[model samples]
Target: MESPNNKRKRVKPILRCSTNEQSERSPDDQLAIIKAMADARDWEVLDPIRLEGRSGSLHATMDWAVEQVIAANRAGEDIDDAIVYDQSRMGRTGGFAFGTHKQQLAAAGIGFISVDCPIEGPHADFIQFANAEAARAQAISIAASSARSSQISLERGLRGHSTQAPYGLDRLYLNAQGEELFIIRKLADGTSLRLDPRTGAELERYPKGVRAYRKGGLETATLCIGSEEHRQVVIRIYRLRHEHGWRGVRIARELNDAGIPSPRGRHWTKDTVDGILMNEVYLGFAYARRYTDAIYFRHQDKAPERLEGPGGRKVRGYRPREDWFRVEYPKLTEYLPSKLRDAAARWQAAYWDRYEDGHVRSPERGQKRLHALSGILIEETTGQPMSATQSGTRANPKTYYLLPGSHQYSSQESFLRRRIPSAPLYRAIIDEIEMLVCDDDGLRDILRTEILKAEAERRAGDGEAESLRARYEKLGRKMESQIDLLGEDDDDVMRRKVEQTKAQRRAVMERLAEIDQGPRLTADQTDELVEQLIEALQSELAAFAAAGRPAFRKLTEMLIASAVADLRSGTVSIEFAVPASMIQHRFMGMDRPCEPKWRTHTHKWKSLPLAAITVELPERCDMDCWEPFEPKGCDDCRRQRRTA
Candidate 1:
C-alpha cells in the first residue's frame, strides 16, 4: 500500500452529469457540483486567475490566466487535469480561451473539466465547442422569452421590468429601516422611471404609482419621457417618418445604418420601426391591452403555402375602430399625417370595393377595367371629369356606367345604352383600331410623350428618393464615427464598418438616379412611348384570352380603343348598357316599356332626318362604324348623363 501522504495526493474522479436536471435542467447544478468536488477532495479547483495588480480589467485577467496555465505546465507538477465552475467564468470571451489556452494545456497531457456539463474526454478536443453551444442556446432562450414578455406587457399597457422612470418622475425606494419611502412628485405621462430625481434613490419595485404634474405649473413636464435617453427615441421616430418622409422599409434601413439602439438596445427591424410609427403612446397617451399572461406566449406560425387550403381565401368583416381601447399618452403626431397615408387608405378601400362589389376578385369588378378613360371624359354642363359607377347584378353579373346629373334630362332619360354586353362594343373598337393604325406610330407618340409625361411628373414630385438620400447621409456619418472610435488592432470592426458604408452609399446613389426634374420626354419620344402603352394593352388582352376570361379581355380592349379615339380626335364618348335614371324595380304586371310623362325631349329641327340602320351594330361594332354625333342644342345635352 502507498503511504498516507501519497494516498492524500490521489486525484478525485471528475463528476459526470446526466442530460436532465431539475425541471428539465441537469441534475448536476452549479452549487451541487462545487460541494461534490470539495467533498471528494478534487486535485484542484482551478479558480479563474485574477491579475495581481489589475482588477475589473478583462484583458489583464485573460493575460494573467494564460500565463498561469503556461507556468503550471512547466512546474513539473502532476497536473493531470484542471476544473472550472462553468462555461461563462472559465473564459472572458465565448470560445477564444478554451480553444487556445485550454487546447494548449491539454496538449501537455492536462485535461479540462466542467463540473456541471456532460461533455468530456480526449475526443472532446474543442471543449469550447460544447461550452459555446450551451451558452448560445441559453442566450437565445433568454432573448426569445424576454421579447415575448415585452410584447405582451406593451400590448396590455402594463409596466414591464425596467429600471428607469421618465423625466419629472421620482422612484421611491426603502430606507435603511426598510420602511416605505417618501413620495417624489416628478412623474410625467409617457415617461419611464429610473432613479428618484429629488432623493437620488434607485427604483427597485413596480407599481411605483406615478403622479401628474401640478396643473398650470411652470415646471410641469408633458411626457413620461423620463430621461434624455427616451427623448432621443421620440426624436428619431419623427425624423425618420416626418422629417425624412421615409416609408417603413426605409425607416428600418436608416435606423440600422445609424447603429441607433432600439428600445431593447439591439438592431432595428422593419416590424420594430413600423411599431414605433404606429404606436400612439409617444403622442402623449398610453394605449395598451388591458390583460395578458405574465409569461411568454408564442403564436403558431402560419402554415406553408403548399399546406394552405383553397388558395388561402380570407374571411372579411368590419371591425369597429372605436371598440379598440386607446389611452392617450404623451406624444407628438398620432401617425405621420401625410399624403402617403391618404393614398394608401384610398388604395386599400378601392381594392376592397373591387372584391366586394361583384363577390369576385376579377378585373370585371375593378374600376381600372372600365374607367381607364374616366379622368379624360368632361361633362359639358359641370365641366368636371366623369366618375364611373358600379351597378352589381345577379342574373347577368356586374355592370359599370358613368354617374349622371352632369348633363340635361338625367333625372328622366332612360340612359341604358349597353351593359356587360358593352364589352362587345369595346372589342369592336379594337378591331377598328387594327384596321386604321398600321405601325402604331400615332399610338407610340401619345404614350411616349403625353401620358408618360403626366406619370413621370407625378413620380418626380414624390419625396421617396429625397428621403432616402437624406437617410443615407445620416447613416454614413454615424458609421464613420463608429469606425474612427474603433482601435487600430480591430481589423474586423473596421472591415464591417467600411462594408456597411459602401452599401449605404451605393443605395443613395441609386435613389439619386431616380430624382428627375427635367422634362420626361422630347417631342420625338412620344411615338415610342405610345407604342409601348399599346403593347402593354395587347399583353393584357393576351393574358385574358389565355385565361379564357372574356370580360377582362373586352375591358382592356375597350379602354385602349377609347383612349386612342379620344386623343386621335378631340372628343371621347361612351354609351352605357343601363343608365342610372333607369335603375328601378319593374312595376308588378307591367308589360310594355313606358316613358314617365315628366320626361321631356329636346332636338333640333334639322331639315334631314337621321337614318336608323337595319342591322344593330354588334355590341362589338368597330370604331370605323360609329361617327362623331354633335349635339346642336345646349352644352348640357352634349354631355352624357352622369348616370349614362
Candidate 2:
C-alpha cells in the first residue's frame, strides 16, 4: 500500500560549497537526495538549480538563488519554495545573516525548505541556532586540519627533506668519483643498505662504485655544469628573472618561444616561473608552506552568481614567510651567491613593472644572449665573472657586459675598466662557436648516437604501463555503468551493492595508482623522437655554418663550458666539455694565438679561443678535477699547477 498526493509543490534546489571541500559529496548527489525526499512528499523539483562556491561566506551566489524564487513567481513559473539539502548550506557566516535570508524568503511567500536538515518543523528556531553553531564548528575543524598538514610539510622542509631537488640541481653523487646517488635505504637497526645492481644482494657497507638505479643509466645520472644542456635552461630562466629584471611571465614566454622544455615537459607559464624564482631550494636552502591554499578558476556565466568584488578567476591565501620552516644545506649550496640572490629577490619584489605589466621591453635590443654565456665569461685580472647590463635608455640601448667582482676583485679592477661593449664580444664568441660546430662533429656524434640510444633504452619499458593505463580507463567506465544501474534506495541490499562496487573500484584504482609509479614512455616512442631530432639537427647544420647564433643553446652550453679572456696571455680560454679523456690535453696542441680586434677605443686587447691556447698537458683525466670551474670549487685544491 502506498500513499498518494494530488498537489505537487514547485520547488528549487540550492547548494553551496567551498572550493576546498572536495571530500564532501557532490552537489548533484546532494540534490538527488533532496529530490528523492521531494518526490516522496509530492513536491515538484524545478529546473536550473543553484550551486555556489565558498570557504565560509559567499553572499552573492546565495543572494542570486533567493532572488530567483521571486523572479520565477513573477514570470508565472510559480516557484512555491526554495529547498536546500542541508540548512547549514544556507550560511555559517553569522546567525544574523542566516536569519535575515530566512526572513526574506518567508516574506516572498517562497518558504525556505531543507530536505535532510531535520530542524524544519516544531522547535525550528532552536534547531536553526544549533545548526549555525555546528556550521561554525565545521569550518574551524577544516581550517585546523589544513593548518596542521601545512605545519607538518613545512617542518619536513626545515629538516632538509625535499619532495624534489631544486631547479638547476639534482644527482647527489655518492662520492668524489661522482658515481651518481640513490635513495639510501635503512634497516630497522639503522644500517644503510645499497642493493648490488648486478647481484641484488644487500651490501654490508655503502659501496663507493654504486650509482642511481635507472633503466639505462644504472651506472650514473646526467653529468651537469651550471651550463649543462637541459639544466642550462633553468640557469637561463634564473638569469632572466634576476640579472635582467625580467618578469616571470616574460621569462616564461621567452622560454616557450625558444622551444625550451619545462620540468614537466610542457610549455612554461608565469606561475611555474614564479615558483622557480621563489623556490629557496635553488639556493640550497629548503623552504615550504609558500603554497597552502590551492587555486581554482571560476568560469563566467557558469559562476553561481555575480561576485561581490573584483575577483573570482584565481583564489589563494598565502602564509607569512616568517611562519615558514626553512632548512639550509651547507654543502649543497651552489649557483648564485647569497648576497646576489637576496638582492635580486628584494629588487623583484620592489619592481612595479612585475606587478602591473603587459611588459617592460628588455633594456637591450636584438636577440640577447639570455642563454649559455650570459654568466660564463670570467675576467682574468680580478677573477670576476662578467654580468649583463644596459648603459643607454630602453629606446636606444647600448648593452654592456661588465665584469663586476667581489669585495677583493672590486678593490683590484677599477670601475671604468669593467664595462665593455657587449655586442662585438658576444658576436665574436658566437662566430667561434659556429666555427667549432662546423669543423668538429664530436658533440653532434654523441647526441645522435650514445644519447639517443640511452633515451631509447629508458623509454622502452613504458609499453606495459601504457597498456595498463588503457585497461584502467576501461575499468573506470565499467564501474561507472555498474553504479548507474543501482537504484537510489538506501536499503541494506542497495548498501551492500554499493559497498561491493566501491571495493571493486578501489582495487582497480589501487592497481592504476601502482602503475602510475612506473615509466610512461617506450623505446619505440623514443626512437621516433630521436629520429625527429636527428633530422632537425641535420637540416639546421648548414644554416649554422653561416655567421649567426646557434638555434640550440644546449649544444652551445655543451661545447663551451665557459669562455675566459686572459688579457695577459692575449687569449680567450674557451674550455670545451668533451667526454674524451685523452682529448683534454691534446686540444691545446692545436693552439694558435691571435689578437681579437675590439670595436671600442677604450682598451687594446687580444683574444684567442681556449681551444687555440697552448698549455702543459696533464698525464691523464683526473675525475677529481673534472667538474666545471667554480670560484672556490674543487679545482682550487687540485695539486696540478697550470703551466701556461
Candidate 3:
C-alpha cells in the first residue's frame, strides 16, 4: 500500500581511502556522512562496501565493488542506485574509467550518485566529467609535488623520504642540531628494533602495527654500519670477492652451506650476493634521483601523447647518470676501509672482463641445436652441470658436453678434462632405454616397484601438505589483519610488509595446489595404466625413431632426470626422470605426475668404453699428470707464481 513517490530507493554506499592520502576522510567518516545523506533523502542504504588502503587511481581495486552491485541489481535484488561519498572516491582515472563505470551501472538499470557532487537534470553528465578531470589533475599535481620534495631532500644530503637502509646497515636519525638520536634496525619479522647509539642499549621494539615507526618532526636520517655480527659477515664477503676472486654464485653457495642467513633471512642466491657487491652504499656513497616515473606508448612508431591519471601504462625508467645526486658519507669508511674499497673496485672490473670473454667465446653461443641432457649432465669431479658445446669447423661440427671453467683455463689444460662426446653417450643411454621399454616383463616389474615407492612417498607428503595448508591459512589471516590496520598516513615500509606477506601467502597457496593435483593412483588403476602406457609407448617410440634427433631429444628429456660422468674413471651414472607408474599415468592423457626420488644406477657400457668416451690424441704428450685443471697452472706452479 506504498505510494511510488514516497517509496525509499534501495542503494549500496561505497567508501574508499588510499594510504598516500594524509588528509583524506577515513572510510568510517565517509560512511557516517553517506548514511546521514541517505536518511535525509529517505533512501534505504545497505551495508557499505569499504575499500581501505587501496589506490583510487587503479580501476582494478574498485572493479570488485562495482561488479557486486551490478550483479545484485541484475539478480532481482532491487538495487535502484549505487552511491559514493564522492566521484573521486569511485576513481581518479579521469573520464575513461570513471565514465565507463558510470555507463556500465546505468546499463544494469542502477543509477550512479556521488553524494558530495550531486548533479541532477540535463547537465549532470557534463558536471560529472568536469569533476573527474579535476580529480585527475589533482593526482598529477600531488605526484609532481612529491617528486620536488624528494629532490630537495636528496640535494640537502638528508635521506630521501621512505628510503630503507641497505643490508648490513641501519638508519640513524639525527636531530635538527645534527646530534644522533637513535638507530633503527629492521628485523626479519618485519618489525624494527631501536637502539641507543652511545651505549648500544635497546630503546624499544616497534611492532608491525598501523605505522612502521613513529617519525619525529624536523629529523634527518643517514646510514650507519649495523651490529657487529653483520659487520663481520660484510667484511668476509668483501674479502672473499676481492682477495680470493670468488664469483657471486660461489659466494652464495658458500654462505648457504655455512647456514648463514641472507639479508631477508632466506637462502642466499647469486643475485642477492651480487646486489650486495654492486651496491655503492658500502663504499660511503648514497645516490638519489636514480629513476623516474614514465608512461610508454604501446606503439613505438607513434608519437607519445600526454595521458593524465594513473590509468596509462606506467613504467619506471632509469635517469641519466649525470642527473643523479650523490651524497658522501665519510663515516662509512670506518666500516669499509680505503684499501678494501679499492680492492673491491679492482675485483669488479676483473669479474666483468671474465664474464664478457666467456659470453663471446661460448661454444653454443648462437646455435639452436638441441642437447638432450643439457641441464642434467653433471661432471662428477666438480658436481657442476656440463654445458653443451660445439667445436671443430661449421662444416664438420663436433658436439660435446663440457664442464664449465674451460674458458678460464688454456686449451691444452681443458682438452679432455671433464668432457664427454654427445654422440657416444646419447647412443648408449637411448639403447638402454629402448631395451627396457621393449621387454614387457621388465616394464611390468619396474611399474610394480615404482607404484609401491610412489604410494609410500604420497603418504609421507600428506603430513607436509597439511602443514602447508595450516601455514597458508595463518598467512591469509595475517594479511587481512595488516590490511585492516593500515592507516591513511602509513608509509612505504608498512605497505611493503603487506605486499611481502601477500607474496608469501601466494607461494604457499601454489605449493598446496600442486600437492592437491598430484596423482594418487591405486593398485588396480596402476595395472590398467601400465597396460595403456605399454601400448602407447610402442607406437610412440616408432614415430619418435622415424622423426629423427628432435624427437629423440624429446624422448630423452622425458625419460632421464640426470646423469653424472667421471670422464677420467670411464664411468657413467644415470637417474631416471620419473617412476614407471607416473610415466604410465602421463602417457594416458592426464596431467604430468610429480617427479619421484630417482635412484642413480651406474653403468659401464661395453659398446662405448673409456677409450671411446675420452678424447684421444694421435700422438703422445709429455704432460700426463692427473691434477685438477687450474686456470693459471697446476697447484705447484700456481703457488710459486708471482703477481705484479
Candidate 4:
C-alpha cells in the first residue's frame, strides 16, 4: 500500500430526479454534472447513487452515502466528503429534519459539497437568506405537483379510462370509433407496455409510460358497464345486510358457501364484504384522487417531513371527503333495478349501534348469572367483589359466589361459603330497595325534594345573570378593541392588557353558563319524570326483572353505593349513595372557620349517610306474626299452635 499520508480522497455523488420532473431532467443528466465537478478537482469519485425521489428530511438522501463515508474513513480509505447537486434538495421539511441530518453527519466526521449552496457555517449567515428562497420554491413546487396530480386523475376519470373500474361495473375498452381494444397481458416484442390497473386498458411503459392508444373519428377511450352477475350480487348483498338484517361476516360466509369467487379469486372475507358495502360506485358515484401522497405519509401523532413508510414504500392513507373529485353516473340504476340505498343506510346504522353498545361476553352455561346479584357481591375480608365459581360438572352444575379470604388464597378454615342462593339474594336486595322507595319517609321522598328544589332554582332565573351577560359582552368587545389597538408601539403592554381582559371575560362566561341553562324545563315535564322514576323503583318484581343487567348496575351504584360481607361477624355492611341532611344541618352558618381547626368544611361524601354494616337477612324471613320466637314464645297461643 502507498504511505498512509499519500492516499487520494474519495468523493461520491448523490443524484436524484423526482418522478414529477424525471422526464425534464433525467438521473443521467444529474450524474453527468456531478462527474464534471469531480473531474475539475481530480478527486477519485465513486459510482453515483440514484435515489429517484426517495423520502425523508432533505438530509435523508445523504444517509446511505454518509454510512459509506464513515466506513471508508475507518478502514484507512480516504473518503471524507459527499457531493450533491443542490443543498436545498436535501430536504423541504424545514429546519428540524435537516438540522438532525447535519448533526448526524458532523458526528460521523463527514462533510458535504453542495454544488449550489457553496457557502455555509457560522461566517455564512447570509446563506440562510438564500435557503429561505429555496424553501419557498419547494413549497410552491409541492403545491403545484398536488394540483397537477388532481388534474390528471380528474381527466382520466371523466375520459372513461378503465384502469380499475369499481365493483358492480366492468371496464370495456374501446377505440374512438367504438371498436374495442384488446389488453395484451404479455409483451410480444422488444417494447414496454402494461395494462392500467384501474381501467384494464393496455398502455405503454412501466410506471411512467405514455399510452400509444389513439382514437379516431368519433371514438372515445373506454366505457364502464354493469357486469350482470356482479350487479345482482351487489344488490343481494345490500338486501341481506339491510332488509334481512345480516352481519358483514355472515354475508361473506353466504357468498363463499354459494361458491361465488371474489374479484381477487380468493375466499370471501368480512373486510371484503365491508368494502363492497361501503363502495359508493354501486350508488352511481365515482370518486377520484381520494388518496394522495400527503395521506400516504400522514400519521396521527405528527406530519412527517418525508413521504415514506416503515416498509420503504408509500402507505395509502384515508383522505378527507372534500379533497375527492366526485362525479355521478346515474346509469347504475339500469343494472340494480331495485335500489336498496335505504337498506344500505340502515345496515350501516345498525353496525354502528352494535359497535357502540358493546356486547356482553357470555360465561360458560353453568357460570352465567341468571340472578342479578351475581357480580356486585363483595367480600369484606379481601375488600374485593365475590366471584361466581362452579363446584359441579357441566351435567349437574352448582354456582356460588364465594369469598376465599384475604388475597383469595383459598384458606379452608377462613373462607366464607354462600349463605344464600343467587335467586334469594336478588329477592332480598329488591325487597330492600322497594321499602326504601315506596315508604313516604324513604329515599324516594328525599330525592323528589332535591329534584323540585333544583327545578325551582332553575326556573327563578338569577337576578344578577343579565348584568353578568352585559359585562361578558362588554369585556368581549373591549378585548377586540384592545387586539385592534395592538401595534408596534408598546406591544408588551398591549399583550398584558389583552391577557388580563381575556381572564376577566372567561370568568364572566363561566358564571353565565352556570346560570343560563337555556329555556327552563317545563313544570309538567319535570313532574312527570320525577313520578316515572319513583314508579320505576316500586315497579312490580316483573318490571324490575325486565331491567337489563347494565341498567340494574347503574341504579344500584346510584343508590346503594357499595355492599360488603364479613364472614366472621356474619354481617353485611351497606353504604348509600343518597345524602343525609342530618349531618349537613350541623354545618349551617359555619362556611368559614372562626379559628382554623374549629370550623369544618363538608365534602359530598360526608353529607351522604354514614356507611352502615348490619347482618343481612332475607326479607321474607323477618318475624311473621305466625312464627314463634324463643324469647317471646309466640304473639298468640293460636299463632304458636299454627306454626307448631
Task: Tell me, by lDDT, which candidate is best.
Answer: 3
Off by over 4 Å in 2: 1-8, 19-25, 46-53, 57-78, 107-109, 118-122, 141-240, 243-245, 248-276, 279-324, 327-644
User: Where is the poorest 10-residue window by lDDT in model 3?
Assistant: 599-608
lDDT of 3 by residue, 1-644 (tens): 11132235678888888772322347878888888987787666777777777667665666767877764553345566888988889877687777888888876557888889877889988889989988877876665555555555555666642377777888888888899998888865557788998887988886643343544546778888898788788888888988798977778777867778888787666787888887667877755544444332211112222334335234444544554556776667678766888987666556444433221122223334557777567777667778888776787556667765443332333443555656556655655555555666766776566555645543436478789879989988898888877785775667888989977876665445334233456566667756766665556566666675667666665566557777556556775533232342343444324534220100000111111122232122222321112121112232233210
User: What global local distance difference test value does model 1 have?
Assistant: 0.39
Tell me the lDDT of candidate 4.
0.50
Clashes of 3: 0
Clashes of each: 52, 7, 0, 12
Colliding residue pairs in candidate 3: none
**Once superposed on the true structure, which residue ranges of model 4 sit more than 4 Å away at CA?**
1-6, 20-25, 47-50, 53-78, 95-99, 116-129, 141-284, 288-325, 329-644
Q: How many backbone clashes does candidate 4 have?
A: 12
List TM-score per model, in order: 0.22, 0.33, 0.41, 0.33
List ranges where model 3 is wrong by over 4 Å: 1-86, 104-124, 160-162, 188-193, 204-219, 227-277, 294-315, 334-644
- Local distance difference test, each candidate: 0.39, 0.48, 0.62, 0.50
Root-mean-square deviation of Cα positions for candidate 1 versus the true structure, in angstroms? 31.2
Q: Return the top candidate by TM-score.
A: 3
lDDT of 2 by residue, 214-239 (tens): 22212322211222454567667777
- lDDT string for model 1 (541-582, tens) is 445435543444344323431221121122344432111111
Model 4, position 82, has a per-residue lDDT of 64
Worst 10 residues of 2 by lDDT: 599-608
Per-residue error for 35 in candidate 4, Å, reads 2.7
